[model samples]
Target: MSGHGFHVHGPHDHAVEHAAHGSDKFSGNIAVMTAILATVGAMFGYQGGATQNDAALFKNNAAIDKTEAANRWNYYQAKSNKQNLAELAMTLPGADAERYKADVARYKTEKDGIKKDAEKWEASSAEWNQKSDAAMHQHHQWALATTAEQIAISLAAITLLTHKKWLQYTAYGVAAAGIGLGAFAWLHVDPIGALALKLGMGAAGH
Candidate 1:
């Protein structure tokens, strides 16, 4: 058959080869990106979860303080009632009149101390409630920002996978996400989580 002097392989072969190479590269890139994303996501999720726990713990502590204050106040009231009964008993003409008076005096002293302690605990509980609220607010903000940043990273990663030519844009997006995550970790999670983790480690060691 008469044909062009330059004999070449079919164009389809080259196209297929090119596509195969591109697919391999894309697959490798996807694996690497998935690993990175998973790691970052876990870190972010753990931080968010820990902060939520801290907020819960703070709330629980505040509740405990309030319960303690209430108990102390109840104890004071009961002691005051007992003191009044002792004073009544002291008025009776009996050999134990002096002992009854002494008992009443003791009850009065204990009731006074309990009243002061209850007041202190009341004030302390109020302060703890305020602190717990502030911690909850801070944790909520951190969780929100971290969640947004993770979403942005995931979206950017998907965009990059779809459009390889936009690799540069994805790099910038990744850097921004990293910065945001670092800031969130440092400000919110690190402080509280580190302490809890340390205590956990200590307990585990034992």
Candidate 2:
């Protein structure tokens, strides 16, 4: 889902070596493998789409919370200015001195409540940030999984073309990795995301 907003781009292009179908060394076997790959590939693709959608939803929610927090802080600042003004007005010598002092006390109490509300909104924003990060991490996992699936499908085609046992085994290995990555995404295990974060931080230092 990554480069821009909520919509996800398609998976990367895979270089598959297709074999000619008419009895060209186990074409029937190739057909079966292709069918199986098609099914699994569809499932992985759907999961990737779902992951991207979830990530977008979280990002949107985080934006909402951030905006609300900003508004709350603005309100807090207005209240603070009012409290300061009331305090300053209390210094004037008049029959209204007591009234100005009362206003000062009221403003101070109202400012305290505003401060709490601002802090609560800030905390809410932080929570939303965490959620958005988590969703993005899951999206990365799904992207990796989908890439692996594509590679596996390519390898399966190449295996049929060359009839190499090792190549078939490698295809299976890639497919297993795809399944594992998909599980990581769904389970919210964040090894790949953590590694990316670490690498990004390291690069920024340079």
Best by lDDT: 2
Tens digit per residue, CA lDDT, model 1, 1-206: 34757656332233333344665665455445544544555566676677677777877887888899999999998998898888888888765888988998899889889999988888888887777766666666556555554554454455434655465355447646555645755564455566899999999999
lDDT of 2 by residue, 1-206 (tens): 56676863222122122333245656455556656665667777787777678767877777787787788778878877887887787787664778877887887788788778877777877787787777777777777887887777777767765788888789889888888988877787877658999999999999
Task: For each of the candidates, give the backbone clash count.
Answer: 0, 0
Worst 10 residues of 2 by lDDT: 9-18
TM-score for each model:
0.56, 0.77
TM-score for candidate 2 = 0.77
* Alpha-carbon local distance difference test for all models: 0.65, 0.72
